[model samples]
Target: ELTNRSFEDPPGSSVTPSGWYDCGFEGETPPDILPSPTLNIGKTAYHRSTYLGLTVRDNNTWESISQELRQPMQKGACYQLEVYLARAHSYWGISRITGKEANYKEPALLRIFGGFDGCDGRQLLAETPTVSHTDWRRYVLQLEPALKPYDHLILEAHYGDGPMPGPNNGNVLVDSLSNLIPVDCNANPGLNKNPEPEFAKRQMLSPKEADRDLPLPVSEAAKGEPISETQLLELITTTAPRIAFDPAGNLEHSHYTDPLTNKGKWANLLLKNILDGLAQHPLAILVIVIPEKDPNLAALKKQNLKEALVDLGALQEQVILRDWLEKDVEKVWYGNAESGVLMRLIR
Candidate 1:
């Protein structure tokens, strides 16, 4: 099951909703989680208090959000999800190309990408033609990953062929996503599996129900500057003094960390280390080592760690998860050991 599937996380003009990470360009602002009065969209949410607002700008860049899935999507498997989509004709933004205010009223389409990381966009799984409706409408997207398996999903707003063809301002409102359901790949495509009148009722949760299990907002006192790489290295060295090292004093493995055992202070420290590292370097990628024994449990373990990190506000592109034994025979899971999580610097 997906966490915060209905986009129930709190909203802000620039803040990425909880459980989702921004995947916009380097210099671009992140997508807005909205229903804010300041945006002046003059729209109520289709489901709860807020919805996702994505834009395709004239500067050839667009907005998107991604999250690591609780379960990896199996290759060649078919999955469908229901969501509400609408177009806000009064949406406005400052155009980068024109250097002035402009209406982002043009319709935009939704593009879904699946990959092994939070923002890889390795495979384009599904795309809608365009959402031109001013009222909330239900859309069931069918995704079939024909290539490799995927553990992450991305929702992107893209330009559509409107009356004026070239790149311009466009906005799409997304809300109330249903659970991702697997179906028969060969079944008649585009047919609604559940045509009952109460289908919509089941998709949307009440406000009280939506708020349940949601993470509490981070207070100002809990926020601070991220730690530097140098600081992080020192922390690891000081905290894990018994860690095995090579002749050159480089890290070989940690004696204190055994993912299956000793799940207390050391584990929390390890999580903190990861959180600090990702916060400092937002673009870095993670590499999770999947062991041969109980591969399914290993996948679930990785998902749990991912959710933990995301819950603590770590939003970088996560590691590409795989069964190391099946993918490679020469390279060991963690240099010499059988299991552990590895963080790699992409630079």
Candidate 2:
């Protein structure tokens, strides 16, 4: 079970709240317990009156809030972790001189890390892409701790590689954290089995009605054979190849020399296809991979993709954004620049 899931108790404080502790940053300030609906931030917590607020600095320093679980999470158990997160969209840190809010556009970011030792021995579990939304959005991740039981979780906020810093600061708000719930991995509900119910009913159509209503399948690719629905479902429910976007933020064409007329359009179509697949596979989790090179550029691309998905009505919690180190990228898809977002379905 989780305590203070909404950060509601110990009322009206800007310091640490009850049942949670500030995970220090060694010579930096601790996280704050702030009123969510304040005039400055202008948003309420997903659940209650208050939420945890954290900041990232220009020097790359950040802050974190952590809690020790009521019971240890069992090893190898599949558990769902959910939280509501939002970026300030515009916030300069608490002013030292005037104590007033300064306006800025630095993107607020949050990463979830789990561990056996109190906020130490942690491994990067899941994180959001550049959080630019002022509204609170839910984010979910399925955690299967492999080697040991984890009793602690940390939520760290930082300035992602994008967004120029003002007085070296950015902020993120967090609320409504959920306790881990074990999932029955083998159970495939009929709802999931029939991904598109309305389309499935099309079989009831008379041949004449079908001919009039259903459009013929049009293949777009020039060479590859079409995949079966079963294959498509498998691809949606299982892990996929790492997709890398163009480093220069060009979603339109694979290369500058490529004679593609609708590069951007194709990129949007690819994203829409992935979103459609996820909608069919409700249990599937979406993860966005961000490369380490040029954090600012990576952050911007991540934010843009996330915004596009959000516009398509994807829940913030159902998707995860993670950063990839240069070495990690090379290990998988080496020398590919035009690749777009990579996705993996949670097992």
Candidate 3:
């Protein structure tokens, strides 16, 4: 970009080269960003040969990875974020740092449009925990469009504490960038499907037959009327741990994203209204009226909330509603029936 008048890093380094990527020397090439301290990964992760390389500074810190893709997301539109991540080093002993060091947590950061002019797009969406093991894992996250339209996108990864683990602590590799307006279902599902041992229970709490019920207790906090929020919170506090043992839906995003979606215009208003009704009591059940045109609505109505720790402190034990065929598919129900009347849990 020397003669072409394109952007370059802030001085002190060699002149900009004509290539697909520009590494950080005295300073990084403008636009193309770095996710870490050292810039030396191969151009691509699973390419025929070499992969872009970057240096990891410490542990539990996030490195922002971004690109100069000039796509302006509308103010009210929704967008999905997706990328692939893997542990940098294969050998454990060869890692940069281990526990209790600088890069302690080995965090990975996937950022979007972080440091660009005009737009304040520091949307660091997804994070991978301290990765001590070696093996490539793909992670995807969904982000709402910023209030202002942004042209650039940033991707990043961070090390929590010290250096790579004792020869074993190594760099985390991230690649396969995919985002934008293209409606790719696999890219922006807002869910992590593979974590070896998924936190999802087989199903939500379901009744054994049709009228099974498990209700909450009366603690004299209120009269013989409806349950109180303080009492409900009290019950949840005692039961969060017990339910955590059999976590079903998303534990993290459920609280973080779900609530916000309900309030936003981009979200499904019908579904939000149904959920609002169920919150009246401790046990909430919601049913969706599916139309024939939207066959996928059946699938979407089901909540396979694994890592988000959904349905915490469910009154009854999570019952797996068996199907007639009993194939690969399984069903579940949530309910509470100890409060005089056996009220089934809302879906």
Clashes within 3 Å, all models in order: 1, 10, 97
Best by TM-score: 1
lDDT of each: 0.62, 0.55, 0.31
Measured by C-alpha RMSD in angstroms, how accurate is candidate 1?
Answer: 17.7
Model 3: residues with Cα > 4 Å off, grouped in runs: 1-44, 58-65, 90-107, 113-115, 118-121, 129-133, 161-170, 181-347
Error of 1 at 243 (Å): 62
Per-residue lDDT of model 3, residues 71-164, tens digit only:
5555545555433444543212122234343322243333344335423345443344544433333344545444455454544434433353
TM-score of each: 0.55, 0.48, 0.34
Better of 1 and 3 by lDDT: 1
Which candidate has the highest lDDT of all? Answer: 1
* Candidate 2 backbone collisions, by pair: 138-317, 139-317, 140-317, 161-295, 161-296, 244-339, 244-340, 245-339, 252-263, 252-264
- Writing each residue's lDDT as its tens digit, candidate 2 over 1-347 gives 77777777633334676787777667666666655334255444444356777777655567787788888767766666666666766554554445566554467777777776566746665566666766665565556566678789777886665657443567777876767767653442331212211211222223554442333222221113455445544544331222333223322211111133432221233344455555554565666675546666677567656655664567666677667655544443322233445554562
Off by over 4 Å in 1: 190-347
| Residue 20, candidate 2: alpha-carbon lDDT | 72
